[model samples]
Target: MRAVTVRPGAKDSVEVGEVPDPVPADGDLLVDALAVGVCGTDKEIARGEYGTAPPGGERLVLGHESLGRVRQAPPGSGFSAGDLVAGVVRRPDPEPCGACARGEFDMCRNGRYTERGIKELDGYGSEAWRVEAEYAVKLEPHLDRVGVLMEPTTVVAKAWEQVERVGARSWFEPQRVLVTGAGPIGLLATLLGIQRGLEVHVLDRVTEGPKPGLVRDLGATYHAKDIEQVISAVCPDIVIEATGANEPVLASLTGTAPYGVVCLTGVSPSGRRATVDAGAVNREIVLQNDAVVGSVNANLRHYRQAADALAEADPAWLERVITRRVPLERAAEAFREQPDDVKVVIEF
Candidate 1:
């Protein structure tokens, strides 16, 4: 099988080549790769930012957002041939921390979790892949073409789940939501927010692009100016920060309405100086009785929620999210970021 291979921690080594077929264990299900979504993490891995190969392996496959079809499944595995599926990326470490033991590997503590494509495991950027029966999720037949999006959808699903939980800390009836950075995560966050019947506003730098229209089509307001320009006018009740930029993150804390909840979903780079008044921001949170939390990754429950979110979304709108699709032969190009790119996928 031909697979996208990369030498862990080595820059500019991503390439497609033949590899041995996956070895399935007794209870494993073999999935035939159909599509895989490319994102910033794949680019980071290619740039030698951080990636790990499995034990005794030199190259790691380079995709985590995968959609596939079942080629082989153990009888009564709850999946069959031709079923669309996605492989669960993260696995609990051998220690099996309390969270992982409860099937929430996304919340695995002990810093020893292994994730496909990004850390210590081969990924699904290939023609052939396999995962444990319990770790793979089946998709509705209608989602075969768009299911590559399920992984990113799961990210926002988990974030929304956290938002609802955090909002319950006080008297909560959120009506407005502000999402920073209208990228994939931000837009998906916006989608989930609209699904909840909230007044949604998205902030991004581009004045014209697919993003503004995408937001508008979903009946959400889009802003190209800095968040500081309108934070006071709208007084958002829930702020989901997906920019990973320091300024917006700081603003989100102080800009929310009293008792508002803010969820930081972006992983910002370290060492950037944030110009803000720490004491004032603290005072705002304390005085307003607000809650701020961070969310990442997704467990099985979030995956199911993501599927439902996608199902509820207009199919045409979901198709628009996947702005481009490149075949397996042109996989490398899909990893490059483009100005208009909302989501790029590699079709096998």
Candidate 2:
């Protein structure tokens, strides 16, 4: 089998080459790779920003967002060969650790990567892969090719879960919400906010087209050209920062309404941190009771919900989100086209 690997400790580590095919163990399912989505995290890994590959492994496969078909499944494993599936990247061990006992395995100190073509675990961006049968979930037969993106969409779904950790209200309730930075995460938060009936507003310094159009199409108000001008005109009740830049984070805090909640959804660039008016946040906390929170990679249930939403999204609208489609061989090119890139899927 051919797989993408990051040569450990190499200056520019990424290389696609022939590797041993995955062999299934008892109660494991073997899958044939179909599609995988490259994420910002993958780019970071390639740049040696996220940390080296797991111990005792060379050229760690670099993919987490994936979709594929089952090629083999152990008897009575509850999945059959030929079943199409899309699953979350995290695989939790069933040991009775204190965190696992409380259903907080995502926070489990013992949790480790046990999936295909990932940083620690080999991921699904390959000719074939295998994993514990229980880790794979079957997909609906009618779902289209975009279903491969279930993994990234799961991040939004998981954020929704964390958003629920606080409290969520319909945007239609006349509650104004501001999404900072018009990147993929920001756009996703905007779309989810609009779907939930909020009067959504977005802020970003970049003067661009499709992103603003995409937000408006999804029923949110887009604001860029002048961020402060837009903020002054629209007082938002909730703020989501997804720019991965410090300025947006500070601006999001500045524009939030009294007693509103702010969700930090962006992955900060390496060695970067937001500098905010601490006095302002302090004043807001005392005067308006505002809140700030953060979210990360999703759990198993979020994977299912994200898939459902992606599978149900309007075909035309979803098609627009897909900026480009590149083959496994062009993975490097996909990374180079960052800056204004949206969804880039790597087909196996």
Candidate 3:
């Protein structure tokens, strides 16, 4: 089996190498990899930005957004050997205390973030990876091609869930929504907003990025170099900040309409700390009643919903978000050349 192993150093250290293939246990299923999306977190981990693994694990695999077919299924797995599936990456005890009991696996005290082709469990970027059958969501036959996107889409889905949880209804009607950052998460949120019958608007600082055209093509309004201009004009009821940059997050806070909700999904490469204007936010809340919240990883329900949504959405829309597709062997190239790339999936 072949996998992308991270060599010690910076973001450019990832390399492809032959590794032992993962085998399925009694309750596990063996999946032949199809597509694996390279994420910003991958870049961060490679650059030693987030948590680090122990010594030898430096040779760890590096992908989580994946779609594959069940090459083999355990005797009682319930899935057929040929089923096309997209799986949830996080694995947790079905029973947990406090927050975890409410399905917040990402916040579970015993939850391990460094799992699956990451710092913990082996990941799915190899030619074959195995997992418990319960994690895989079977896709419709017609959706095999676009279903590979289920992994990232689920992320946006989870963010949406948080928006709704944090009183999204008090924000605005489904008619107007603003997405800050024309990146992968923002684009997907725009698509979801559109599907929910909202008029979507996307904002970005770069006047000439590779994503504006695609945003327009996806039926969302694109705003370049002028996020403030678009917000004042549109008065969007919902604003989703996906850039993870302090600028975009602050813009979302100031720009949302009174009583509107803002959801933050971006993982800032510069760590979680940001110097926000607390006084302004305090005053704004008193005057306008706006809400600001942060959203993170998905649970079982979000993963299933995202898989279903991707399976049903138009393939043309999916294609627009997927800027590039590289093989597992070129995983480093995908990360190194990420600035201009939208969503680069590592095809196994």
Candidate 4:
């Protein structure tokens, strides 16, 4: 079997080549790879800025946003051969933390969690892969065309969950939501926000692209103005920050209405210094009773939530989100930026 493999910390080391076929372990499901979504993390790994191979291995399979069809399933696993599934990424550390002990490895406090295609595990970027039955999420059959989006959707699902949990701290009836960035994460965050019956407004730099139309079609407003201007005009009750850029992140910290909950889903690069009015930022949060929480990765519960969310979403709209699909032979091309590309997937 040919798989996408990369040498960790070696720039431009991604290649597709023959690898041994996967063998399922006890309670593991063998899946034939259908597709894998490429995101900033994948690009970072490709660029040698992130990622790690399995212990004592020279290469790591390079995908976490996976989609596949089960080829083999253990009896009583509640999964069958031919089921469309997406594998959960994070695994609890061997020395389980309190969170991981409770099946909340996404909140692992020990920072030793292993993630498929990321930390210390071989990912699902191969022609076929094996995943533990408990970690595989079955998708709706109708999502065959767009289920590659399952992982990213899980990310936003977790973000929304964090936002709601923070909001439950007080009297929270949010009407308006401001999503910063028009990328897949931001857009999907908007979709979830709209599903909650909130008025969604998305802000992105690109003035001419499918993003504006995508937002409009979703019955949400799109803004290409400066972050300050958009945030002031919208006065959103909740802000989902997905840009990972300095400006939008800084503005969102103080840009929401009173008692606002800001859920940050983007991971910004370190060492990018920004000038901030620390006192004022602190004052705003304290005075307004606002909350800012950073969320990343998803657990099993979030994967189920995302599967349901995508199932309920319009298929056409989900299809549009996947702007490009590259075959596995040219998998590296998917990492390159392309204008008008919302989400790029590598098809096996």
lDDT of each: 0.90, 0.70, 0.75, 0.95
Question: Model 1, 1-348: lDDT tens per residue?
Answer: 999988978888889999999989998998999999988889889888889999999999989999999999999899898999998888898989999899988998887999999999899999999899988988888988899998999999999999899887766889999999888899889999999999999999898768899999999999887688878777999999998998889899999999998999999888998677889999999999989998999998998899899888878888888899999998878878788998999999
Candidate 1 regions with alpha-carbon error over 4 angstroms: none
TM-score of 4: 0.99
Off by over 4 Å in 2: 93-97, 109-119, 168-174, 270-275, 338-340
Question: Which tens-of-lDDT digit does each residue in 215-265 have in candidate 3?
Answer: 888788888756667788988778898887777677778777777888888
Q: List the residue pairs that clash in candidate 1.
A: none
Judged by whole-model lDDT over C-alpha atoms, candidate 4 comes out at: 0.95
* Candidate 4 residue-wise lDDT, 1-348, digit = tens: 999999999999999988899988899999999999999999999999999999999999989999999999999999999999999999999999999999999999999999999999999999999999999999999999899999999999999999999999887899999999999999999999989999999999998978999999999999999999999999999999998999999999999999999988889999999988899999999999999999999999999999999999999999999999999999989989999999999998
TM-score of 2: 0.88
Model 2 agreement with the true structure over 1-348: per-residue lDDT tens digits: 777777644556777788888878888888888877777777776777653455586668767777788888888888987788875676555464675556455555765434344445666777787767666767765554766767766777767666556655433233787888776677777777777777988877666757878888888877775656676677777777777677666666666666667678788767775566799768766786666778777766777777677666665776677777778876666656666677887778
- Return whichever of 1 and 4 wins on lDDT: 4
Better of 2 and 4 by lDDT: 4
Q: Candidates' TM-scores?
A: 0.98, 0.88, 0.90, 0.99
Residues forming the 10-long window of minimal summed lDDT in candidate 3: 49-58
Candidates, ranked, TM-score: 4, 1, 3, 2
Candidate 3: residue 343 Cα off by (Å)? 0.9
